[model samples]
Target: MASAESASLGRKVRTAARWSLVNTVVLRLGNFATGIVLARFALGPAEWGVYGVAQTVLMVLLSANELGVGLAVVRWEGDLRRFAPTVQTLSTLSSGLLYLVLFAAAPALADALGSPSASWVLRVMCVSVVLDGLAQVPNGVITREFAQIRRLVLDSVNFGISTGVTLGLAFAGWGAMSFAVGALAGNAASLLGAVIAAPGAFRFGWNRAEAGALLRFGLPLAGASLLALGVVNVDTLIVGATLGKVALGYYVLAFNMSGWPVRVVSEAARRVSFAGFSRLAESAGPALADGFSRALRVLVTGTVPMCVLLAGLAAPVVGLVYGHEWLPAARALPWLMALGLTRIGCELAYDCLVAIGARHALLAVQGLWLAALIPTLFGGARLDGIAGVSAGHALVAAGLVVPAFLLALRRGGIGVRVVARACAWPFLAGAAMAAVLVGLPRALGHSLLALAAASAGALAVYALGVLPTRHALLGVEPRHGRHARPRALLPGPSRPPVPPPRHSSESDPEPLLDGTGADGVRP
Candidate 1:
């Protein structure tokens, strides 16, 4: 019975992962294209710098905006209808309070981040927090049920509306405020879609006991998530404060450019990772460790070439995509690329930890990261400007934080040996790919065709190098001299059919909350 249940949920997880990957890839590509247009004509570095500050603030706020109760919709057994009203109430109230605080303190906060001019932008853009709060219940329903197809349609609407509005306003000379307004419109679309996906999901009901249980369960998770987000966003603050807005702008561009693989692969995986891992934890089987190793291997293998090539081809990519004026961003891109690769592994580990109720451990690792980051980041900016900061950020993530996380995972039975094994092949392939890209002659012109050809060549080498990951990607455990098909993707002839998932008398518990369903499109 237990094996059957795992198999059923495994099917759902794989199917959800497929759709989620599609959703993230499509939206990221759309956002990337829109960003190119904006960078080329609509906005310059200073404007982008201010927008980046506002964006950083929004991401940080959104991480804790709901106080983390929304995930309860995914993890708890029994009828969601019993406690969903309270979840909505708690989410809405918390977000409303947070927005109010930000509204009153925007100027001071913007100034602290070295962007006083962005005070208004921060105020306007953070309105989505309240909208996110109101919609968390419905969105949680969507995630719990692995409803990525619905999410895709909804997020597409958000992308179209946001992109159209931002472009129109930028052309009309609204500056950074254009991004804020456009984001507001986009979040509204997200809310509407969430409601449509799960009707009557946003109701206000307060059960003191239920609310207490939720807070008990959620606060630690929220704190951990906030710290995790801080580990990523605090650099923007440090950059803006230690350097100037223009330097901050360069760093932001470089960092975002480096995030291509992390966003596309990690975002999609995380949308379902917590819920899936939570289910796996309940089974208390070796499946969690096995699944973790496989997922980590796949992510590292797929992400390696992208990160390596982006780092190697940073100069051409920034030059061709954002124009010659933005070439300075290239210097910081390689270091940020390393950071992006580290984040993919760490984030997957984070979801696994969160699912197994390892919130304290998460808080410790993330807090240590943020605590270490402030000094390193500031010192780096004082040394080599944005590039130094990027190098410093990557250093902390790989050197300090990655080891810390591995220890925590080791405590959870996912040994360092497992991680090392998973990472060994991908890391070797990435290094080889990097060598090829870095060794390439500078004779290649800065044209699109030239960049594409170089990237294709580097990636082809990477593909061949990581050919052993093929079985893993297909969801089969790889063992030497034991080649077998992945039953997850294509079950064998004699394998029993996975049993259908049984619904509770009250509701199906299938989805979880992602911190950014506060809607994570950067400005």
Candidate 2:
């Protein structure tokens, strides 16, 4: 019975991972393509710089307002319906207050970033904060339920609307305001979709007990989030302050381009793995350990090669897609790509800790990472400008963040030796691919088509090189006890059915947040 349940959970994880991957590819690709159009044809570096500064400030505020409540919602094992009202009330009130604070502080932040126009942009974008807060309940509900397809549809709708509006306004010469306005529109649309998809009463109610429980679970995660905000945006802030807006613009562009692999692949895996790991942690022991190991293997295998490819092909890619005017971005890409590679491991480790409710440990790791990152980032910006910032960021990630992540994983029973073995083959494969890319003939490397072909060839070589480790790569072997083995990467028909919840009652609604219903939606 235990083996059957493990197999069932594994199937669900695989399915969720697949759908999340689809969503990430579609949403990120759209955003990436639209950004190219905005950077190359519609907006200049100075404009992107202004927008980037405003966006960074807004993100910091948003992270604070969120306070990691969505994670609390997922991690909670109690009755979610009983808990919903308190979550909603706290979220709405906090966001409203945060918005007021951001609005008041906009001018000062704008002065700090050296963009007078960013003051108004920051004020305008603060409206989405409240809307995002209101939507968190439903968003959390959807994710908790593993309703990936519905989530995907909503994300697609939001991305399409936001991109269209932003691009249209950019072409109309609205500049940075285009991003602010488009974000507001997108948030509104997404909120509406969430309400429709996960309909439930959201009224003013407060339960002190529930709120306390949530705070205990969420505060440490929120601290980690705050530190993360620093690690991600402090460099942008430093570059804008020291190097001027145009340089910051080039740096932001390179940062975005280099983050494609992490954002699309690692993040996708994280979305699924967090929930799966949370569920498995209830069972604990070898099941959770094995799940973590498999997830780590999958994340490294997929992301390392992509990061290598991006770093190796940075110059041609930037020149062809975004034009030569943005060539400065190319120079920063390799360092940023290296940073992304290390980040994949760090982020996965963070998620694993969160799933197991290891908040203090998570906080400690993030605090250490932030401590290392701030001085390194500022020092690099002062020394070598944008490229130096990128190099410093990569150095901190590889040196500090990666080691911290490995340590955190050890707390969850994932040994360093296990992680090293999983990562070894992918790194070797990626190194071979990087070598081939570097050795490509100049004639073939000069054109976009040739570059694309070369990249495909390199990927093919990586695939072939990793073929000997296919079973481990695919996680075909069960990591724990000898029992029912999963066919392929998913559960088969022989997998056992899950038992009904013990707490079900006539007055209580079904546990829609548990993803046990047929439609996978809350009524």
Candidate 3:
């Protein structure tokens, strides 16, 4: 019976992973294509730089928007729905507070980030954070069920709406504001979809016991997640402050391009990995270690070739897709590609470490990354402009953060050997692909058609190189035990088990706000 249940869980995980990959691939491709249009048609580096600033602020806010409690729906067992009202109350209140903070401080924040012009855009784009918070309950419910198809539909709705709105506005000369508005529209659509998916999820209620348990569980993870985001977004802050907006725009473009390859595989894997790893962690030791190894191996194998191609062909890619006017971005693309590749592995390690309830380890690793990043980024900007910044970012990730995360994984019984063995093949294949790409420019010439053919050929090489791991890619996780503990909603190492939400909760139909309805709507 246990064997049958394990097999069933494994099958579900595999299915969810497949759907998530498809969803990510489609959305990223759409986003990529849309960016090319915007970059080439209605916007310039300066506009993108400003948009980058606002986008950065919005992301940081979103990181901690729910204060981490909505995850309770997935983190605990025993009628998870009982925790919904408290999670909803906390999520809504926290997001509202964050939005107010953003609104009141938008000007100062913009100036601090060195893009005073981004103040209005920052205010507009950040509306999504509030919506994201409101949607957290339904979102968590969906996540707990492995409902990736519904998620795909929700995100597709967001993408389509954002695309339509952004394009229309950009063509109408809205510039950076177009992204702000489009993103806001997309989030609104997504929140509606979430409500439809999980009816009655949005309500005002608070269980004192559940609230305390959630705060204990969520705060550290939120802090760590925020730091993780800082590790990524602070680069924009540094570039804008040092090189000014246009240069920041170029850097943002290059960095986004680098993320293309990384996002293709990493985002999909992450959607299910944390939950899946949490389940495996309950089984402990070997099962957890082995599952992570396979997950890392698959992600690294898939990511390597794309990273190599993008980094290798950065010049033509920028010139052909976004036009030569944006060619300056290519200088930073290679180093950023390197950064993106390293980040994928670290991200998988992040999920594994989090699953094993190593919050302090996650915190320390992220803090170290952020600390190392600020100094290096400033120094890099002082020396060689955006490329130097990219190089600095990549250097810190590979040298400092990656090793730190590896050490953290030791807590999960995954030693250096496990990580090295997982990564060795992908690194070798990537090096070969990189070697080939390095010499391709002279032979292929710098034309759109030539670059296309070369990219196709390079991908074919990667396909052959990684063919040996094809079997492992589909069946990445084995039939592991599925025992889960309530406290592992990602606990800090120093924390103890939550004492049963004080033996449970009571549902409340309090209004969402001063004059709002039970569904959080003001009518």
Candidate 4:
């Protein structure tokens, strides 16, 4: 009976991870398409920069408001349905409070940043945050229930509707306000979708037992989130302060362009990985190690070449995507790509560590890195403008790699040397592809046709090179584990049925990493 249960749980995790990954990727791609259009037609660099700052501020505040309740809810090993109302009430109240705080402080915040216009932007964005917060707990419940496709559809519909609305406003020359409009539209759509698909009322239950238990777990998670966000956004804040709105706009453009590649790949990986690791953590040491190893391989193999390709193709890509006036972004691309790659490394370690019940370790590492990041950001922004921001990011990336490797080694018993060995081939292959792309274009006089052919050829070569290397690193083709694969979703050869580990305790362990031996996996 125990073995059968474990097997069933493992299969469920595998299936959920795959679907979640697909849904995330599809959603991101849809957003990406709309973003490209918006970036090109709807907003110029300065307007885009303002939009970026507004959006970034809203995101930071949103993260603060949720205060890690979603993770706690996921970590809740008890009855998810029973916990749902409490989570909903808590999240809604917290968000409402945050909205009040943001609105009260908006004028002062705008003055502090020397941008009076920010007050209006901040006020508009606060509305979205509140609505966004209302959805978090219900979203968490849906995720816990393994309803990823529904989540995906909700996200798609929200973004699709918002994009359409925002584009119409942009065509009418609504400028920076267009972004705020789109964000409001998107949040409203998201709230509506959450209500329809996963209905839950937000009564202030204030269940002391439930709220207290969640807070104990959630506060640390919240701290970790704040530290991480602070590190990531300090550059923007500093750039905005030191460079002013117009220059900050350019810097943000570069920053966003640089981060997009990593976002594309990591976003999908994270959704699947969090749930999958939670499920696998219940198994024994060897099984956990195997899962960790596979996850790392997937992250590195996907992220490294993307960084390399983006770095190499930075100029052309910027021209193609955002037009010629935004050429400054290219200067930051290589550094940003490098930063993106290290971020992928750190994230892999983070997911594995978190899944294996190392929340304290996760918080500590994130704090240390954020501490290191502060001076790097301020000094870099002051020194060389936007490029300085990239320089700081690069420095942080370089510093973070060793620590991440060590943590993965310490927590999961993954060897540093083994990681280095696995990374070697992919790094080499990426470098080779970069060289070919760079050399071929110049040699052929760099026509658009020539560049296209060279880029295509380089991609083909890189793909061929990574295929064998990936197999060696992961012990199988990654396509085998891809969430979108029908065979993978079905029971198949790679997914041989394995028995669940036996348990004779008072309760089954929660499947996710929850600072305990929980046997349940929440996405």
Candidate 5:
């Protein structure tokens, strides 16, 4: 029975991973297509800049609305029935309040941006804020309940519908409203999907104790998010302020393309990690350490090479996706891709912090990122164009990211050596692959076809180089390998001595329990 359950869990993990990867690819592709086409038609530099600013405001508000309510609920996974009401009631009230404040502030923000037109965009997006907040508690519940696959499916469908609607309207010459229409459609679809996907009847009632716990867990997250948002988006703000809207539009194009892969991988990993890690934090030092190591291995392996390849192929990829008019963005692309590595690293560290119940540490790390980001961005934007802005981000990433990881590692009681060990070979392999891709394409005068061929070859070579260590690090052989078993991707039990002793008082403690739920392992 145990074996069967384990096998069932493994299947679920693989299915979820597959669905997540596919959904991310589809969503990114849809956005890329519609955005490119829209850029060709309706919006220009200034309008795009205004649009970017408005979206950032909306995102900040939305993030603030959730704060860390979802995380707190997931952590309080003791009783979903009680937790659900707490989440719903608190989030709804908070969302309503935030909407009022943000909507009221929209006009002043428009004035700040020197674009009164931004007010309407901000107002329209206010609806998303409210809807997003309402969705939060349910969405968190679904995800924590291991019903993520359902959430993924519903959101994917919503994205498809939204993208289709937006593009159709855009081509019909609806201008900025086209994108807004699509967003509205997507949000509505998402709300309905969340409602259906959620497990129980919608209920809301205040519980002061639960709300206090949630506020403790969530407030720092909100602060962290706000700071991180500033760290991430300040470049665009600077670009719009300094270089004008046209340049900001170009920068957004490159930024989105480069950052999309990171978003897909990191967000998927985070969803799984947040739930899985929170559960693991309850017991077993080695199990938690092993889990962290294995998760890092898979994330770095998958993310690092992709980032390097994107950096190498930035020019051609951007050209193909967004058109020649966006060619200037290619200069910004490699740096943007480099920024993804930092972004992913930050995510990994944050997940570790969340896993270890050190949310405050994560908040501090976010503040560190902003501290590094601000001055460099100011300097970079003044010195260079958007490209310089990207360089500044890379600098901030390098300067502040290490401390975040160190802090997470310390808090988790996991040795930094474990993380470093997992990262070494993958980083080397990715770097080597990147160098090969860059050299091969340049040696061949950088034909698009040649770049494509070289990229494939580089990835293959890198994979081969990592093959020996793959089993140890990735916790599984390749999918096609001879050692076939369910849950192959997960790490086996840690050797007893590798993990710290469970307690000084006990002579022998049973091994730490395995953290489950990746690929759908129930236990």
Candidate 6:
């Protein structure tokens, strides 16, 4: 029985990872393509700068709206339906209030950001806060249920509509307003889609005890998120204020392009892992540690090569995709891309901490990261400008955040050695790929065809280098061997079987929140 359950959970994790990967790739590719069009044809440095500053402000303020409540819903072990209304109500009230505050303070924020046009843009974009807040309840429902297909469908629809509208407006010469409008439209579409797909009673309700429980759980996570937000955006803010909007535009563009692999692959894995780990914790199974190890192995293996390629091809990629005008961004791309490798592991550790209800530990780690990040970013910006900022970011990520994450992992019962072992092959593979990319002839012109061919060759080399470790990468051998029965990463007595719940036609049945549903695994 224990073996069967372990196999079942493993299958579910794999399924979730597969669909999550698909969703992330589709969404990120579409966004990247659309951004290319906007950057190359529709917007210039000044316009993009203004938009970037406003978007950064919006993102910081938007963190308040999130407050980790949605994540709380996913992590909660009891009846999620019972907590839905309270979460929805609180989110709505908080978002509405925050938007109002932002509306009034928009002018000051714009002045501080050194972009007067950003004031109105910020106000216009505030509508998305409320829209996103309302959507979180349904979004949480889908995520908690591991309904990846529904999430993919909803996000695809949202992206299609939003990108179409943004491109149309940009072509019409709306400038930064296009971004605000597109964002608002996307949020609206996502909310509608989420509500329709994940049907639930999401209404205003006040449950004092439930709300307290949620706040207690979510507040520390929120602090951690805020600290993270500050770390991410502070450099952009500094660049904008000190170096001017055009320079800031270049920096933002570089940062985005460099961080693409992390956003696409690492984030996908984190989302799925969080859901899977939450379920595993509820089951009190040793798979929590095993899942963490395997997920880290796969995430590192998958992301390292992509990051290496991005760093190696930074020049041609920027020239070809975003045009030569944006080539200055390439200078910062390599360092930022290197920084992304560290981020993959840190993200996994943070998710593991959250899954196990170690919010305070997560908070402490984020605080330490912020302590190292701010001074480094400021000094870097002052010393070498944007490149310095990127270098500083890379240094801090490797020196501080990575170590902090390993400590958090240890606190969560995962050993640093486990992660190190998982990382060894990927690092070697990535190093080989980087060497090939750097050593190869620079005779190729900066064209899409040239870049494509080079990327293919680099990927081939990486594949060959890592080929012998295929079983580990694919999770085929588990901790033993191919034919051995799967065992948990940590030794423990098997959990007693949980009795099946009784159901009646008269009483509406609640679906099991065991990361599965009647159809199969929910993912």
TM-score of each: 0.92, 0.90, 0.90, 0.86, 0.87, 0.89
Which pairs of residues collide in model 3?
A: none
Better of 1 and 6 by TM-score: 1
Candidate 4 at 395: error in angstroms? Answer: 1.9
The best candidate by lDDT is 1
| Model 3 lDDT per residue over 101-215, tens place | 9999999989988889999999988887788778878877776677889878887888888889989999999989998888888778878998998787767787898798888
Which residue pairs clash within candidate 6? none
Clashes of each: 3, 0, 0, 13, 4, 0
Runs with alpha carbons beyond 4 Å of true place in candidate 2 = 442-453, 478-523
Return the lDDT, model 6, position 428. Answer: 88
TM value for model 5: 0.87
lDDT of 4 by residue, 383-433 (tens): 887888888878876777456647645666656655676577677778888
TM accuracy, model 2 = 0.90
Better of 2 and 3 by lDDT: 3
Query: In model 1, which regions exceed 4 Å deviation?
Result: 442-453, 477-483, 489-523
Rank the models by TM-score, top first: 1, 3, 2, 6, 5, 4
lDDT of 4: 0.64
lDDT value for model 6: 0.71
Using lDDT, rank the candidates from best to worst: 1, 3, 2, 6, 5, 4
lDDT of 2 at 325: 92
lDDT of 5 by residue, 1-523 (tens): 5445435444555555566566556666666666777776666656566667766666556556665565555555345666567767776777789888878888887767555677777777566666766776566666655565785677676777777777787678665556566776777777677777775735677777767766766677667656766777777777776777678777877777776777667656665565555545654677668767777777777788888888888878777866677788888888988888777766666665765667577677777777777778878888888899998888778766776667667667878787788788888888789878978876776777787789888999789867767566534545665764334333222322122221100000000001000111100
> lDDT for every model?
0.79, 0.72, 0.77, 0.64, 0.65, 0.71
What's the C-alpha lDDT at position 75 in model 4?
42
lDDT of 1 at 402: 96
Model 4, total clashes: 13
Clashes of 1: 3
